[model samples]
Target: MNKNTTIEEVFQNHERPKKPGALNASATFAWRALLRIRYVPEQLFDVTVFPIIFLLMFTYLFGGAISGSTGEYLDFVLPGILVMTVSMITMYTGLDLNKDIEKGVFDRFRSLPIWRPSVLVGALVVDAVRYLIASTIMITLGYILGFRPEAGFFGVILAVLVLLLFAFSLSWIWTMLGIIVRSEKALMGISMMLLFPLTFLSSVFVNPTTMPNWLQVFVDINPITFVVDAVRGIIHGTDAMSDILMVIYISIGLIVVFGPLTMYFFRNKN
Candidate 1:
């Protein structure tokens, strides 16, 4: 306890922490994220209110112009909107991590005795729940707006799972950004700037064939387009082998690239 204590003595006196298993450590952090949600219930707004607003607005505003009737457009757009909404909400993983870093909690967490990546994994688990809530709202409201999925309830569930898997993979990219960025605002800005163009420019809003030839090239290759197409296939009970495979490939590619990069920065960042 002396002020003159040497570094060697300090090291000798310090007790090493017993490390928890990966799943246990991650569950701890996941529980912490869920508890924070209870105190800050506004966190639910994006997955709830925002999805509703986007659904109603897009369904009514452009529905007739795009598909000849609101009902017709609702059927076409609902799957796309669901994909976009869940994708947008994935940014929160980065925003929350940035805030934690700024507030100094991230450093404290780093000092804790646990699997390091569990912190990231745990937060991701919570975000998955948020995505589920958003998906449910979009599908339920779509029904009210006459957007029936011919594939029925079971099909809708499959669509939701596919979107969640893609969103989970996408979160790794944001998780890396959150570790690298100086502020939550910067992370949000950069993420939105990238996501808006990808989602809007894809087949989400209109048919790719209707797009200009040049623009159609991008739409045809866009990952969001693949996800939207897969969802539409699931909802309509159609064969979507190519779309589903593409979505899976995109998700795996994201995780393979960003997952390690995020952990590298997370472990080494000052």
Candidate 2:
């Protein structure tokens, strides 16, 4: 007879470790997502490179045309660019989800006994970190290029918080699309269609007051306009209570609407 401990005896001798709770499972998943960044460093290009390009290009190319000077426009548009850069990056959430689904990892994720929402929630948690990274890069480049916030670092913090809340809420729509969309190409097309009009038609590049009444009406109702105004107010030390409130309301509404939709489809997806 074998004197060495067998697998059966080892199993009998050791109690099973405690099962992970919802928060723990979600955090573990988030860490896994973070580790993915190591092998696919290119995944960070949008969050890293695009913000810098938008700030420099928009400030130099369109600055004189719109705001009469690059310095003034940098002060005016840095907040808007920050919002745009982060907002645009949110689409990648859907793209990545669709990729995982195609690769069949989501099926493995689903089979686990962990909390059902942990997968999506974990991705969103890591995405918040990405948003912060994009904000930091943009702000640092802004400083180098002479953009100054009147409300200073604290105000920058507040503005980024609002932006992150909105961005996280906005990501749910893409998450749903990722689960439902047939192909990544179609998803990218849909994202471009939605994002271009939303970002370009708002107050980011030009003031709505300078446009025709009809265009102004559309701009006034545009949700991006409210976010930009809120950030602008926070950064410039102005009274933007209404815009801030609007952003909060919109973020809550987005989460309430799309959050459940994402989970429903995720549970039912083929």
Candidate 3:
């Protein structure tokens, strides 16, 4: 039986793995991304501690000056701070991608028999989880600090869902940069340069009307201004349908522009 074994006998193996579908492939990659968090627990510090720090520091430091009382400013700034915190941290997506490429991890992933975009798709999923964690931390602390959403819990949920959608679209821009840029540090540098103006110069901290004419123009056109307005409106019970729709439109535009670029560089990457 041993010596007479033919090629047909050897070829008749039953344990060959069927290729995973897109969702299954994506979930597997998502698990891999989560394990990195398990091994390097510091990955969570941004989503957890930074939200607390940003909330407390900005609320206490500028609250009275801006709104005449900490309580009043807390109501206004909490939603703004939530957007700022999550948006700032979205750069980590690019940083992680660049790190993987530099370490040649992407090479091994590309050689595998799996849906290719699942790597980036899985990253987007994990970042959404991180963004939700940051949003929850910030909002919960806001509630303890005398902040209340006049639109109540339903509005809070709606605002968060909108925020998560915008963040998902925004990640594609960073993902494209991550594939195009050569180093993680460079990716971070460019991301901050883009994020600072978009967060600070927008209506996150103050009304765009309070800004100078030229600055107001940028603030008016800034996509984040619409997002912050939409979120703040949801919390305050103001009509924000137009702003919400603008945020959605902007999100669609970003995905249309950057999603393909990210994939193009990823596939053609040297």
Candidate 4:
């Protein structure tokens, strides 16, 4: 036998396929995605700056007009502003996903041995960190501006957790929209089109009682309003248990409905 034939035969007899563990695969993918964010941190500034600017502008411009006193209105509007900021930043999930698809990033992912779900999970985890940072900044800014949460530290923490849960669940909807859309611009347009009505029609800037009867009904039913109201109650200790329960139920329902659908579509698109 030739020297090359002898070496090939020897290795071929001992060679065995190596199987990747589920945990290893997931960790590797998660690390890769996290490192991407670490390398490109400017992406996070959008979440940080927008919330601060909005809070300041609205608090100064309309705070007095809305609540008759800037200090009183800041407390009332801060919770709603927090919710709106989180929701707005979450829209970036779709835009990022759309860009990745357009740039053939999914194809690069396909060439890897990682589990399919790992990709989406990696993205979600990275975005969740951004959301947490943004939330903290908004809350701290509110505090500096005389927005006190009478519910104390523990209650404030719980409220933050609830808001994060709501934001995470809502991200699935935007993630799906981003994947289905052809361009990042289109994705942004579509997400904003849906977000505008949802944001404005809720009890965000103005009290629902100030609206017409029909508008009040819609605002009362809007899920974002419940989230805002629940956070407000947790901070102020003024809202009822029934309202908090409603928010929890609606958030859970959204996760159940959209979470699986997002995964299904993401998998198929990949």
Ranking of all candidate structures by their TM-score, best first: 2, 3, 1, 4
Question: lDDT by residue for model 2 over 1-270, one digit each (tens)?
Answer: 268878888768767667779999999989888998878999999999999899999999999998899999999889989999999999988998999999999999999888999999999999999999999999999999998899999999999999999999999999999999989998999998999899888998777899999988889999999999999999899998899999999999999999999999999998
Deviating ranges (above 4 Å) for candidate 3? 1-16
For candidate 3, write residues 44-122 as lDDT tens digits: 9999999999999998999989999999989988999999999999989888988999999999999999999999999
Q: Write the per-residue lDDT of candidate 1 for residues 31-132, one digit (tens) a residue.
A: 999999999999999999999999999988998888899998888889999999999999999999999999999999999878899999999999999999
TM-score of 2: 0.95
- Scored by lDDT, model 4 comes in at 0.81
Among residues 3 or more apart in sequence or in different chains, the pairs in candidate 2 whose N, CA or C atoms overlap within 3 Å are: none
Of candidates 3 and 2, the better by TM-score: 2
* Residue 130 lDDT, candidate 1, scale 0-100: 92
TM-score per prediction, in order, is: 0.93, 0.95, 0.95, 0.89
Model 2: residue 126 alpha-carbon error in angstroms: 0.7
Give all candidates' CA lDDT scores.
0.93, 0.93, 0.93, 0.81
Model 3 earns a TM-score of 0.95
Worst 10 residues of 3 by lDDT: 8-17
Q: Which stretches of candidate 4 lie over 4 Å from their true place?
A: 1-24
Clashing pairs in 1: none
Model 4, residue pairs in steric clash: none
